[model samples]
Target: MTRDGAGLRVGDRPYRVFGCNTYYLMAWAADPNLRRHVDEVLDTAVQFGLNTVRTWAFNDGEDQWNALQPRPGEHDERVLEALDYVVWQAGRRGLRLILALVNHWDDYGGRRRYAAWSSTAKRADDFYRDAACRRCYRHHARTLVERTNSYTGRVYRDDPTILAWELGNEPRCARDPSGLTLQYWLEEMSAHLKELDPNHLVGTGLEGFWGKWREGRYNPPRWLGGQGSDFLWNHQPDTIDLMSFHVYPDHWHMDEKATMRWIREHLDAAAELGKPAVMGEFGKRGPRALRERCFRKWLDATTSAATDTEHPAAAGALFWALYHDDYPDYDRFGVYRRHESTVDLLRSYTAR
Candidate 1:
């Protein structure tokens, strides 16, 4: 994919993403007994007309489930093969992927694990500043990018199936509210990834937080320059091809109006930067009726903005997650096959 001003293009045609985050693909594919589940989820994506799928490509530490890197600089070949399977299968189905290299959270032993591996680190955020932790991250990035998919026999960097390489999942450095720490980390990491694979796009998996440099009324009160992510400054790196931000109104204490405003603000910001923007993740949790209503509202807002002639439209929007019957609705944000109404809503939007 290539960036065309504020839009994205595949060859000469414009490409707008209609997709969902399915973070379990690699883990599911890794287990021989659970490989079928990965197929089931991807099949559902095709059924819904989604052209893209974003999932985790990183699992760290020895104790974590489906740990790809059991220890610093060490990988389990079996799990890596499973990830290869995911790339092959998704490519066969004509779905592009955004594979995140790490995470800011501890769910899959993210920065916390990296920090633990660093002798100079005292906190998770230290992973950004510590040389040892940064080295570990670079090693992982190289391993994955240079890998030749066992199933496809194509090096990951040469594979067109992978849409982009995300820097990390909602990367933040709360220890430095000025946002310079995370911004500098993103610049260094994105440049490194590009140096390894100039064929694909790189993104900062930020949650659209404003930094002290650009804080104002548009920011949520609780996030007024405190999350260590400046959506604007972070994307300034030339190697950063796409701008990404996630939305979770319920968790952020935002109502419907505030949520729409947040979306617009990010879209407008990306337009100003002359790069394509994607709502990489968004979701609502509650009664079935409320969830469906909110989903439709947000989808309409994003779609409408895409068609506007005055400014650049968002490249795409992906909901929080897509899950199958085999998995539990652990987050309450899961969109399952049984949710007929929600499925129809998403399907209809994708058709547009």
Candidate 2:
């Protein structure tokens, strides 16, 4: 059940996914009563016509100064519980989930010092050192899907509540890595996930680097997208189901039109893969007009991608976040203002 040409077939055609990243879903899973909170967040998403929710399952919230490793299912108890409830409650709220498996972006929103993080020239040494870490991630992902599928009380598997499975939020780092190494990880991780829960769609998390590489412009720079991961991103689309990516108008808050143009180009570039080109991440700051413009540009970009341009393979778009907690107003990129309004617009781009 997939749609679009990017290797992602759909249960239904013309399915334009919409949702937000549960950036801190696991970090604050300390409350004894998390059901309501999860419902509230997802509730807002459903209320505004959202179709999905993306959350990170790795990073466990510990300071990742040294080699990143969790306490072997340390937060699994709470994290899975929250997810189970998210599926249950989200259904009640009328929403789905496009869950991310791992992430390198930290609180500072710059560099991540996680299990696979590395300096500009350094490699993901920790990933190489502790085989257990990788194994844990693979196993955990399998369990996540299995549990979701096993849900009996309004089961989530066959329902529309569960979206595609994302493998690694930006598998490539800010360093030039051996293409073989990165590909090996992506192929293996993606395979492992599908083997366990063959029901959901799966794909790697990219920074739109595939399109950027083809266009000769980039965000995290050339060194970040792996030595040559673009080949696999386009040529080997079958390794996963869809082509997912992230993007943000560099250092500009008024590039709504520009953002649309870039996404259109990305879709064109994805022509060969014949897959749905999805913007996994994007953001902006400045006047509300600027943000709304950029958002609208991308919204229009998804519903109608260009052909033979920089990108013609695009399929959908997912905003960076909908911060559900009280945080500083440093970057006004969030769609909401410490309230649920931000989350609302984040998922309101329906084609109705």
Give every collision pair in model 1. Answer: none
Off by over 4 Å in 2: 4-13, 26-30, 33-35, 61-70, 73-75, 106-130, 148-160, 211-235, 251-261, 306-312, 325-331, 337-348
Worst 10 residues of 2 by lDDT: 108-117
Could you estimate the TM-score for every candidate?
A: 0.97, 0.77
- Per-candidate count of clashing residue pairs (backbone under 3 Å): 0, 25
Model 2 Cα lDDT, one tens digit per residue, 1-352? 4654542435454466666665555444425454455556665566556676776555543453211134444444554565565566665666666767766455412123334332232334344224655676766575666554323454444556677777867655334344545566677777787677677777677655543344454334434444445633533646577676666775433244555655655666566566666777777776766676667767666656633245446556777666544534456666554444443455455633
Write the residue-wise lDDT of candidate 1 on 1-352 in tens digits.
8877778889998888889999989988999999999998999999878999999999999998889999999999999999999999999999999999999999888999999988899999999999999999999999999999999999999999999999999998989997879888999999999999999999888888887667463776665578788888888789998899888987888888999899888888887898888899999999989998988888887787676667766888899899988899999999888888888888899778
lDDT of each: 0.90, 0.57
Residue 280, candidate 1: alpha-carbon lDDT? 93
RMSDs, each prediction?
Answer: 1.1, 5.2
**Model 1 alpha-carbon miss at residue 262, Å:** 0.7
lDDT of 2 at 10: 50
What's the lDDT for residue 110 in model 2?
19
